[model samples]
Target chain A: MTKKQTCIFLIIVAAVIAALITGIVLTDGLYERDATIQETMQDVVLHERDKISLFGLAVNPGLISAFIVTGVILVFAAIVRIFVIPKFKLIPGKFQMLLEQAVGAFGGLARSNSPHKNGFLGAYIFAAGAYIFIGTLFELVGVPAVTAAGECVILPAPLSDINGAITLGCLSYLVILSGGIAANRLRGAGRTLKEFSLPVSMSFRMFGALLSGALVTELVYSYLALSFVLPVIVGVLFTVLHAIIQAYVLTMLTSLFYGEVSEPYVKKPKKQREKKVSSKTEVVQ
Target chain B: MPLQLAAVPLNIDWQQILLHLLNFVILFAGLWLLLYKPVRSFMQKRREHYEKMDADAEKKQAEAEKARAEYEEKLAGAEQEIASQRRAAELQAEEYGARQRREAEELAKSILAEARADAARIRAQAEKDARADVAAIVTDAVEKLALKESASTAYDQFLAAVDAQSAASKKPAKGARTEKDHD
Candidate 1:
């Protein structure tokens, strides 16, 4: 669809989802009971049930429902594209236009990297993978679903634990692995697979470090249990750090991929010399 | 205290945690398939469209610049032509003025020569007329003197002759009368 249409669609979908999540959080007894129980426990949970609201929509909130809903929507869109539209030989009209524009951009990026070879597949894979990774992280954090409930979402229970730290590290490693694979596939001459791995590794390392720091800080401060100000401060600090790390990781990976794809076309002097010598010998003969 | 602490058993829901984790993974996959891909694609398309427009605009700008230079060159050529024409006109005017001046000088010279010739003819005629008049006057004066001298001489001679004749006749008459008186 046209950009405006797509945006509108997203907004409408988001609104509907938000409304649904809000209804679920407010009307459903599960989230409220869970919050009360957790409060009674006074355990090592990183966030208080009372302080968290879904953008102020929920009296008490759970983000799991929102994540599930958004996930369903995504899967639904993919299914529609694959089955209904593709089978009928029907174009998505404005939606196709939007898709084409995206394709062209990725195509351009690919072309820039590998003028000789097609980089479209690589770009597509990378873009798709990145989205999946970010979405997964967001789901894990329960942000989108939390936003739906109008609550200030925090990382869920196990993620704040020591075990959670290890889980996140494993997830980071998976992301790095995927990134490395994509880089390798896209890589051209003059670039080693190792070169691509560097950025992927760095991204994971940085993510790990940030997560570690945040977890340690939360454990030490017990800020989530304190007054509202302390929690806000800690949240802001963690978010900023997280955002910086994420941005760095994304940028480095993109650069590495671009470099890998474009490297082959750059001719070495020895090749030039060989060609020149062959041509001269031909002329002389 | 030990008995009271031991009496509270821990209740952990591993199933719920696993379900949530599974849900999170599924949600992430779904989002990647749908929203993120499309949004990114849209942005990329927008970027490409703008880049194409920019390149086209740059090409048009270069063409406009070339056209302007060509127009300026033509204008310079026209200016040069006008300048050359002006010089030619000036030269023509100079030549025309010189021809007019030369014609005027030649006319003046011819006029002066005619005037000089006319003056000389008049002077010559006047001199000729004056010479004839002087000759006539001299002749008239000479004739008048000659006539006066001749008249005086003729008068003197006639008087002398008459005196002689009277003298002779008187002597005769006296002699004859005396003879007659004597007779």
Candidate 2:
């Protein structure tokens, strides 16, 4: 931008910030009940009022957020599949290049990790990575939904919930176990069985990491004075950081374990075994 | 039974877990069908296309190289043929020149021998004519002495008689040459 344009842009940003502060001050006076630090912290931890009914069953905010993220992904996927994908050229444009890079990254991850059986692994990791990344960022929208207790609450990150995290973690472990079985049969299952605590560890790790961000944002918001500008920075910073970190960590772990279990087994020939035995006997003698 | 942790409220609901699992499975299916599979296949096709183009280009280059080699071989063969033909033509020309020189030498030798024979025949004819003139002069002197003329006058008479006899011998030879032509 030119000097004049930059000055105009800064003026516009200042105006927007002024308008936002005025709006916040005006909105703050209308609250009927004040949210205390203890109650807010308890709500963040226990999700005491973040539940809603879905098909007559009580579901947490994470499930609602999962559906929202799923819907968003599917809709966007449909748009690309219908409109943009057909128009992709050999010399790719920006959007096409971005999509290709994303797909290529995951595909390369699979191929490098599981060279022998990468077709399914590539698809699986791509799905898992997309779900984690998109679901983590879903909370940034802060879409309001009515809780079962008739209180309105903003949807949180899907994996911040214990059950959702466990689901993905166990699913990834199951995928790894299947990979092992497909590659080495009983031996593959035995190998996966050795890492029995993998699912619980993976799930709890994601839940803790994601919850820390939510808890910190809740703590920041619990203070009425600090809730204004601080929550924006702290909330965005924590959410984005958790999103990236969790996505990479889970996918990396999944691919690593999948590749490990899916590795093809090589058996020694009978003659080689006999030769080794003879060699050992000769050394002993 | 769900184990409760101290201080933290934990709800481990199997129903919620199943629901979340179902949701993930559906999302995976949708994304796989819509995004991952098509994009990957398209990329794979593009890779295969470029590979095929590269292979075709290599084949064309190989063919061009083969054709160039054949052309060079033909060019070399043509040069060798021209050289061989030139050598043969030079050998024929040399043989012809040698034959011409030999014929010229033989003709020159025959011409020289013919000239030597013609000189010998002319020399023999001149000697015969000289001998006839001397014999005629001697007879004429004898006739002048028998007639008792003075000695000096007799000598003069022999000279004149010799001149007449020489003239007579030339006329008869001319007459003999004409008679031979008439015959």
Candidate 3:
């Protein structure tokens, strides 16, 4: 063989041997390490414990995950701002193109739906959507975290918590209300008030969707038969699907309702001709 | 109760609500500065640059078109001037030719009249000279005839005298009388 081909072949062989040795050393005579995953989950009896206290309130597992998710989003935002934003060209790079497409899609959604074209709703929806999608996926990362009762469990999706869902739902409702009021003043408030249960419905939807995914993964992990290869697949599929679907459902509903309530109120002529014709017909009959 | 607890997935937690609400507020501000503002400004600047370039190209094209039109008009005007000049030259040549013909005709007529006058004078002079020579010749011939007749008469008279003297010696006196009676 040629000298370069021999060298590459030797390098690949060496890498495989080194990986096998390292795996053996790490296992330390345990050939089946993954088998204990189901047993550990069974013995632990996993449950969310609200223990972290501040100002007479208990910060639950969902809040802890929410804090971590928020930090992740903030750091990502900072990196894109500092390094990526300044280097954006007219013909965008891949990362820049993705960002532009994302923002443009959401902005276009807002513009197409909104009557007066509120700017903050689009920005707010983008942030909220990112939070919901990424927060859902964050649970799949399996970050070891302690609950208030000092019991350890994997991180949870923030929206799986009813409180976080309520907050986001109410916030979205407030944004829609503000948009309507800004576009149509007192009439806008009346329109928004007409849909009062919107927040409750939105919150329950988000909470239910993420909670179901979590429970299913939890159940799968706690069992021995399905825990081997199935938990990973099930967890990832449910998380990703729920993340994408819930994000879309929330953003679509907000923008659509925002569009509806924010429409300008035009006074109609008091049905003069139609009412007179109807009245004359009724009298003749 | 155990199955019911297992079935329930959500419960109220006030702290997460407030925390998430605050987190969302921070996230919204951050995303606005990082994503929306800068990208939009870049796009705006690019659009304006393209529009400016288009306007500049259009302006230059219009100017060039105007210059070509002016050049074509000037060329047409020069062609018209050249045609006018050529026609004027032709007319000038025709007038010059007419003037030369008139001069030539006048000169020929005067020369012919002068030659006719000269021939008439020369003919009259020749006639006068011939008439003088004929008169002189006639006068000389008349004088010579008279002289000859006179001499013959004298000679006859002398001979008659001699004959008379001799008749006295013979009969010469009768011949002298006969000679005087000659008609």
Candidate 4:
């Protein structure tokens, strides 16, 4: 599949999962009655055992909140991309330097495989795939939702929270699509899907490992009556560790791909000498 | 367990719902306009700039390699030319040495011939001078012997008698002796 299609698929899957979880959590208390309503309406009502199911089909507040939060995050990401990034001139600063190192490392990998002509584009496509894959993972984990608010909505099974899922899904899809399209257009035929796939696959594997580790750690933490601060600290530490692992995996995979692609183009002295000899013989003949 | 069916009258809040929907739409639209577009564009621009730089660097590297190859080729050619020139100079020096050697040999041969000619001429001249001296000595000796023998013979005696008579009448009979000596 193209990078765009893959990104869309990931985003859609993540959003659906998140929305289902949120919807279940939100509707958990829908059937519960308020004790105050029974006491106040006892004298006024003719039937004492009657009950009411008000707001039966009303949209869950949590779902709306989650959607609002996602929208806000999108806006924030946009602002950073357009205004903050441009203002800071991220190309010359530490971030830009870091990006350059990343690009160089990936480019080297591509060059190793094919040729110098293809390495640059190959690295770019690789980076785009990775960024989108990680973004989808983060979105599914509800990191952006958590950042927006401390709490999120939960969903029940059997009923799909279509609106919540589709909205967030579309947003995630757009972000990934934009990145992928830009990469493809910029790199053109020079970029190879295989080159990009290596990093993407490696990154996903690393992310899965890190996530498993985090889950294990959290499970251990759950056993302890740890303070709020301790849990926060542990969570932050795990996140940082996960990020580091993912970054390393990305770098290693990119370098490997670049190396594989560029090997053919690198001129060997022995080969050049042989060529020269052959040409001379031909000339003489 | 008895299933208790219950129904209650619901109060609808259309205004509140409408207000919330409006709020959501406005907030979403506003945020989308303000934040998402700019950030994405900036990221795209950043990515483009880096890619362009990468391509430029590769092109520059290729150009440098081409130039280096050209320089090495030129240098090799120059070295070969210099080697040929050196070989030619060596051959020229060899030819010059050979010519000088030939000239020296010719000069030495001419000198030797001249010396031999001079010795031969000197020997011939000495032999000629010795023969002439011997011939002159022999002629002188023969002439001396002939005169002495003839004087001892008859003719020598007659010449002696005439010489004695002329010597005896030489003082008083000069006029008369001229006629008598003629008879």
Give a tens-digit lDDT track for model 1, residues A142-238. Answer: 3422433344445432232322323233343344344434445444322444454554454345435544544554453432235245645555565
Q: Taking the tens digit of each residue's C-alpha lDDT, what string does model 3 give over A1-285?
A: 999999999999999989977875686555443435555433222233434544555566677788788889888878888898888886788988898888877777788888476578788888888889999999988887654565555767888777788899999999989988888899999999999999999988887787778777867765555755697689887789999999999998999989988898888677987899899999999
- Chain B of candidate 1 vs. true chain B, TM: 0.44
Off by over 4 Å in 3: A1-57, A228-232, A270-284, B1-9, B51-183
Tens-digit lDDT string for candidate 4 (B1-183): 422223322221233234334443454455435543344345568789899999999999999999999999999999999999999999999999999999999999898677666656665665566557555544654565577655346455555545654564454345434434543
List runs of model 4 lying over 4 Å from the truth. Answer: A1-83, A89-285, B1-14, B68-83, B106-183
lDDT for residue A147 in candidate 3, whole number 0-100: 49
Candidate 3's TM-score reads 0.66
Candidate 2, DockQ to 2 decimals?
A: 0.56
lDDT of 2 at A180: 94
- Chain B only, TM-score of each candidate: 0.44, 0.47, 0.43, 0.45
Error of 2 at B26 (Å): 0.9
Chain A (alone) TM-scores for all candidate structures: 0.38, 0.85, 0.80, 0.37
lDDT of 4 by residue, A85-128 (tens): 55657546776455445445444444554353442334343433
Query: CA lDDT of each candidate?
Result: 0.49, 0.85, 0.75, 0.46
Residues A107-150, candidate 2, lDDT per residue (tens digit)?
99888888888788888889889998888888888899998888
Q: What is the DockQ of each candidate?
A: 0.05, 0.56, 0.32, 0.05
Instruction: Look at candidate 1 and tell me the lDDT of residue A205.
Output: 54
DockQ (model 1, Cα): 0.05
What proportion of the true contacts does each candidate reproduce? 0.11, 0.78, 0.68, 0.12
Best by TM-score: 2
